[model samples]
Target: MPPLPPVKASDSRAARLVLLVTAIGLISLNLRPALTSPGPLLSEIMREFGIDTALAGGVTGISLICLGVFGAAAPRLARRFGPERVILALLVVLAAGIALRGTGSFGALIGGMILAGLGIGVIQVLLPGIVKRDFARHAGTMTGLYTMNLCLGAAIGAGLAIPLEQTLGSWRLSLAAWALPALAAAIIWLPQAFVRQSPAPRAARPGRLWRDPLAWAVTCFMGLQSCLAYMMIGLMPLILEQRGDDSARAGLITAIAIAPQALTALAVPHFAARMRNQSAVAIVSIAVSAIGFLGLLFAPPSTALLFAVIEGLGLGATIGIAILFIVLRAPDSHVATDLSGMSQSVGYIIAALGPIVAGLLRDAGGNWVLPAAFFLAVASLNAVAGWYAGRDAHVLQDPES
Candidate 1:
């Protein structure tokens, strides 16, 4: 009959915070696998379904389209049910989508991807606002963490798809394995939905985000960079295979390009947050990314590994900076939700075009050169938009607003 010593309040609070962050990170780990896993397996899936590259690209494009469409719905759902509960529910949906793809039919496969995108898009829109709401002081660092995990998940999917296929003897089984992690994250996040959150401060209404030039700049930066990012994810492995690498080797190379994303994804936001404005960081990231893309396109196939790593570093930094702008520029969680929804909604829709266009270009020219040139133009525009969006000004600062 002994009583345990009472736990300290500060200690308990710290433990809970750590648990919340872990939950958030775990949830972020589910965001990209569905999008990237199918990349390495695209050729196999296309063969099984008797589809062309354009149709293959449509799978990624479909998800991005759903991502855009659902992104706009996230804030509304959050306002009604709270972000935590909505996220938890959507994780189940995501898991179901992942498993549905395992049915080994093209209809189920495409249907599953659309469901997964619905889960991913809303969860993504809501997370920035939660970070801003709960971890406002460390928004940049936390955003870096979020994005780092997101990229890491993508690398895992791209890197392991072929091996998993070999081990399991079917690509369907490999894709279905991701469902386990989605469910695990949902279990870890169970407690968060019940914890009451601090109320967000009432913020002055900015004019419609669509009407704000600063908001548009942020959207453009996010969209264009995401366009480039998705383009590479959708096409890189295929490009390598066409250049003569085997499926496994191509997947490994694609994974190598994505793995380094974690480093810059963590570093860029931390660095940008300390500066007066993020323009230098944003513009520099864009330049490095463009250089890497061009190198991969024009250099000997022998150089793919080196260029892949370079591309990852720059791409990771760009994504981190894009998300950081959303948290930093918005004055409150409410505004952050609205801005996040707007930026990602429009941005991902624009992003969807990248894969489809690249596919069409390849079909027309019988090579990747046209797609490469198109992406170069996209990167050039991303640089300009990032500079404007990176300025140290709030989206609501206009007097008329």
Candidate 2:
């Protein structure tokens, strides 16, 4: 069949597109706050509740596992309903989860985290396909735009949590404050659910994805980079605190370190898209992140800002490239969402292990040395995966070529 005629920019259509893009940015802004906001308040939560590192790590781990499980389920949901509607419902759920998490009960917190993760999981899988479908010609640029917002949202959450607590006289209120953004994003996104969409093709059955090598490469890269991202989210503040910074400063430092990622996330994907292959950029990003990790481990307290800048740039680049691969490697939007679900489901499951394992090592060894060394080794493996994933071929093609 000939493709549908290109969507011309009529007044209403143009307004819709503008709203959609604004909604996308708003949703992207909501994504990271739920995940990163908790990191800053963890010490107070632990101290008040007598929770230990292993248990604290479990909260992050469980949320990641939910992210994986729900991510895998998203394509099916999107195909059965529609991506826009699914996203709208998830946003409400996310807002509710964020609010419920601050109710002062441990069980409530866990339930809230899982609920929030489930919401985030579906959105993560769907956004790439939506971008691919709507902005096919501008996939890389749009991806970078939304992703930059994701980093900015993360930085804001991490940086502000402590200050919010200071002003509000309770960490619970600080955690609940994130719900405001989610609700506002939902209000902006509400218009999308009402727009009629053409029926999507039935999603492929899940089993075949397990057999695809490029899918595996994409999955590995997603998982490995996520390991670094989640590890930092769950532990960076603690790492800083252990080194002599107070909780508030630690959170702020973590925010400053993560801020540079927004710049690289914006620039790298646009430049990388012009290349014949992305392998070099991929490996270099990992190398840069590895160096940053090394500096954070050994550098004096005074150099924290320098280390943060390096680490953020590297992480931002790697993550931006990872998202780009879902679009770049797929043959179409259907394939892109499928590959996204496959990668995120398995990738997040693998990432779920990172924080808990590091916590265990820290508990056992009583120092950060072993955990840092272990993460370096994982980063090395991530470089190898990125190299293969960067090859100039589609997922359906024989990657060996």
Candidate 3:
């Protein structure tokens, strides 16, 4: 290993910075399609495998659980292999897993999803640290850009899955198509792997994150918001279908709900950076989401499109706020990594329960009303957690205190 050159502050350097950020953005675009594409194709998958809706939902739950559990291990892996290398390796893993999803066996499909989920989990945890380190002066902008790519990926996956399935003659081919983007990301990221070879690793602070109130606040907010998002992803189409909307219309509604995220995802982090306190924004975002849930639950079928847009706005803003808290609450980059690990690890584990429980409610009583109520409860909690996490204060203990 050797010392790396410093990032020069020059016009040419700025141009290179733009290119590097674009590459990273493309990599972010590969993270979510596999997980989300399944939702739109849930009925096709169930029919093909002769499985129930709960079982289909369980598959998503298992993937999410693996995401959380494996996400905790990412920082350690990054420390060992370097963040760039870990990212490249995970991209390969994601590509292979996604490509294998066309195998059509139930076990193979679940295994593929788990592997893809693990890759996505690791990337999600590591990319923020990479942005923080490489774009220190522009972390907020870079984070927003990367997150926008994530939303774009989700929207594209949700929007195009059915059409691709129709053209390819099976859901398996539609699912496997996501691997191409993952492969492209790997190719683009390869040059970055050795660019900063001897960079000093941040030392780990000795503290129990679970005991920190701010950490718990961020965790709870992340979990609760994710619960709402995943519930919509897994069950919204079915709910819409029950109201006499066809599958295509339901898919389109889901796409609309997610598409506005691309704009809000880019906007929230940048705006939050200018605010002295993010609590107001957080409260408003979650409240908006709660109202969106109510709209879906109680509004007439003709108004579903309007509700989708409202929900999408809230979802987009909540994601941005969650990531903003990661940077705003932590004292330094190392603490950001630790806090991210804690928040996402615990948050996702809690989030993984949403779909499973929603499925159970749907199965037991055959109604979406109870699950809709559950989403509202989660949204209320998200508001409270966001208020605390979005406060203008740090979570790390002051050494002199």
Residues 1-401 of candidate 3: C-alpha lDDT, one tens digit per residue: 99988766796667766767877888888887887888878877787889876887877787788778988887778777777788889999999989888887988889998899889888888777767667777767877888788888888888888888889998899989999999999988877776644253464452565677888898888888878778877777777877887878778888888888888889988888788888889889888877876787679988988988898888888888887787777776777777777778778888888888988887887777787777878887888998888888887665543
For candidate 1, write residues 1-401 as lDDT tens digits. 79988999999989989999999999988899999999999999989889988889988999999999999888878877778889899999999999999987899999999999999999999899989988999988999999999999999999999999999999999988899999999999998887755453343353466788999999999999999999989988899999889999999999999899999999899888988899989999998988888888788999999999999999999999999999998878888988999999999999999999999999999988899899989999999999999999888776565
**Candidate 1 Cα errors over 4 Å, as ranges:** 1-3, 197-207
Better of 2 and 3 by lDDT: 2
> How many clashes in each structure?
0, 0, 0
TM-scores, in order shown?
0.97, 0.95, 0.94
The model with the greatest lDDT is 1
Quick one: ranking by lDDT, best first?
A: 1, 2, 3
Q: Whole-model lDDT for model 2 versus the true structure?
A: 0.87
lDDT pick, better of 1 and 2: 1
Stretches of candidate 3 off by over 4 Å are 1-12, 198-200
After superposing candidate 2 on the true structure, give the runs of residues whose Cα lies further than 4 Å from its correct spot: 1-9, 398-401
Query: Against the true structure, candidate 3 has what lDDT?
Result: 0.81
Which lDDT tens digits does candidate 2 get at residues 1-401? 99988666696777888999999999998998888888878888889889988778777888899989999989989988888889999999999999998898989889999999999999989999988888899888998998898899989988999999999889888988899999999899888888756466456545666788878998999999989888877888888888898998899988997889999999998889878799899999998988887788789988977888899999899889999988898878888899999999889998988888888888889988888987898898998899899988887665333
Model 1, total clashes:
0
Q: By TM-score, is 2 or 3 better?
A: 2
What are the RMSDs of all candidates, in order? 1.6, 4.3, 3.8
How does model 1 fare in lDDT? 0.90
